[model samples]
Target chain A: MEEHTGKKNYEVDWNEYLPGVAIDCVIFGYHEKVLKTLILEYKETDFFALPGGFVLKDENLDEAASRVLFERTRLQEISLNQFYTFGSLSRFNPEPMRIVMQKNGLEPTKSHFLLQRFMSTGYYALVDFKEAEPIADFLSDSCQWYDIHDLPSLLWDHEQIIQKALESLRENIDHRAVGLNLLDDEFTMRELRNLYETILGKELNRSGFHRKMVNSGRLNRIGKKNTGKAHRSPYLYRFNT
Target chain B: MEEHTGKKNYEVDWNEYLPGVAIDCVIFGYHEKVLKTLILEYKETDFFALPGGFVLKDENLDEAASRVLFERTRLQEISLNQFYTFGSLSRFNPEPMRIVMQKNGLEPTKSHFLLQRFMSTGYYALVDFKEAEPIADFLSDSCQWYDIHDLPSLLWDHEQIIQKALESLRENIDHRAVGLNLLDDEFTMRELRNLYETILGKELNRSGFHRKMVNSGRLNRIGKKNTGKAHRSPYLYRFNT
Candidate 1:
């Protein structure tokens, strides 16, 4: 706690961020046939939270979500959608925030902006699982990926945020190529189906799933037909950009 | 102006409402196979806008949207979805707001709350067009449904708001049963398909659309099969509640 509080990076500049509003991200990645999300464990406490940050006065909301995700995961190319804004009187408990401030070596004042109730706008993105290297913020000790079904104790309505994000992601699958970002640039149809199965939390039929994806006109088969399966290797496909 | 500003309803009690946040709704309705949305005409100006309102300090975002919609349409049973949040410096211009205040017989001071920047939460709802009676707010002369394709001059970023709402509505159909609300308690399959076509803004293959809807397991056949197609009436469906 002493080490964390003494760090200069922990200080917040209230004037730079939008007052009474913030952005939180629910970053999804597919791995081991399970849907997972990034979570952060707060320093010097057992509290855990989703990656979140404040929007600057001059910046737009989407840009703020991207910035927050990048700050935590160092991944900038991930596409994000502003799904929903979560503002409820029940989420206004200040205990977790108070602990965060004290751990950062700052004594809370009654007028501190950090203690004010925030109407956080929720944004979400799907990233290639192997690509993101989670980096915790000053207030957090570690950032790591955890299965959506098995999460640690979440802080301040984060469980609800993740639930909303999953629902939005399910709705966004067609218009937004969310599954594409969850896999590498070149992946086999089998791998793609696995990703979808993980995301939707159910198994899909083989030929039906393949036909639906092919008919959607969103997939492009890679490698030449004449190449002949390259020693039994499955045909690779990439989402049409 | 004197007639409007002198009214007590126009006076805002700032302490009771949340600052820096508001809700704007795009209420969708179907008529004559065309998608229509509710629009408001500013009291004394030719400018038009979507029906919108402020959120009370204790009210949740969804509650605020419902309250605002009920206030204008007098329809409380309408179901709503929080699709997106619109926040950008480009949308914060104060001229239109100044005109709105002034038309309501109030002068805009340099530091008036209405003149400040606000990040609006966008919500969309589908309502039975014939059932809803549009009632304008104090600052608006009339609230009426207009064809989405042939909207009047919209104020602020309302045009973009409507576009976003349409896309969200399309995405929301599978999970939300949004088209159900645009119809009465009971409807025939052809009428449902027409609503779907209007909402999607495209013509779908007849058999394929019908098959897909039936297979989705969301629709239930109304009236017994023993009741033959009386006078060539098609089998009706009401979404399974």
Candidate 2:
């Protein structure tokens, strides 16, 4: 009975402990035989980060995620999926920020204290670069897409968040094709092949890739793309959606 | 320049104004034609609840979740997918737990005050009931599975958590299956069918379901069930895992 009472006492004490919660975005776009991720450089703070925003009083989680994506990307109809909620209490520090905080003579107390104790919800999206006009909202100086394999030192554990999102995307690739969002309305078969090869990190047989794409019945074959050379033109395809 | 400083001040204040983070579990199991979930009856407390625990200081969020699951059900080796995070300040009681506090004759101080200002990460898993031998658990009553569609009244926004988990499960069904944990190594196709029907809330055509199951190539057909009925015994199957 005493043991049970002690457990209850602990719960009672922890019940009132208030901690901060924030949301981060991991937006991926595929281009140039490389899987790329959109990251932001904070203008005033000089912090390179993912596009993120706080939850509002009247917003649902899905709404909050959508608002963050739409507002930052300036994309009207892109869909953002809530992939993971990172509450490890350690995901807040994206490595480089430690140096920035120290160099700025800002005792890590102000940033570290709240961050190490807080939880962050991670949302990711795939968007067509042609549609997604990157807007430098909030603290951002600019938003740019970097090759996933070669990312600049990011602030906090944002790189880890990107890696996790890519892993999830790879596992669910057969269920839904995400690279459709990274292309224009019409794209060449070569471009599509490059996107898959980049994400899967293996060179797929060209014929086999085309066969699977055609059989998947999710793409509409369009007119050919002329290379303006004597070479055979590659057919263009658009997502059926 | 003054406005920029004011904006910086707002950003600083924003960190201080965020809500606290918490974790919620959507523990699902299969029973009858109704998909069931494990919930707890809180003793000396007004409502029944899902077994939940706070993320510990020294542990990762996943570790904390597994600890909570093991402590409640005594079931280990379960992998939980962290999918959604709910962050509605109104999710907590808009008013204080005034009646409950009054009943317990406790004063509501700021330190002790409870409002629904939580950002809860949702972790969901499937656990075999035979393995889930609840031990040293906090529940006042035996942990049992209640039909998810017809769940008992629960505290906070637990109902929403379960609803969202089920929706995620349905959306991702083609990529993953959940209820194999609840069944034995060998199960009749009928048993599998029943599980799917319950989750999907729709009766599948028997032959079509069987055909698709076989086509998926993820199941191995074993011998027949030794039922003493005149009708042909249904074939047993095991997961290819």
Best by lDDT: 1
Number of the top DockQ candidate: 1
TM-score of each: 0.88, 0.73
Q: Per-residue lDDT of B102-163 in model 1, one digit per residue for the tens?
A: 98887888777778788999988888788899988878899999999999989889999999
Q: What is the interface RMSD of each candidate, in Å?
A: 1.1, 3.7
- How does each model score on lDDT? 0.82, 0.67
Residue ranges of candidate 1 with Cα displaced over 4 Å:
A1-11, A174-179, A223-231, B1-7, B174-179, B214-237
> How many angstroms is residue A135 displaced in model 2 relative to the true structure, after the best TM-score fit?
7.6
| DockQ, computed on Cα atoms, for candidate 2 | 0.36
Model 2 clash pairs are: A93-A156, A93-A157, A94-A155, A94-A156, A94-A157, A128-A181, B92-B116
lDDT of 2 by residue, B113-143 (tens): 2344667788888777556765323323445
Q: After superposition, how far is residue B24 of candidate 1 from its true place, in Å?
A: 0.2
lDDT accuracy of residue A172 in candidate 1: 66
Lowest lDDT sum, 10 consecutive residues, model 2 chain A, at A1-10
| lDDT tens readout by residue for model 2, A76-184 | 5667777787666566444554454455444555445323445667877887655667776533467888788888887667888888888777766654547557766
Model 2: residue A123 alpha-carbon error in angstroms? 1.5
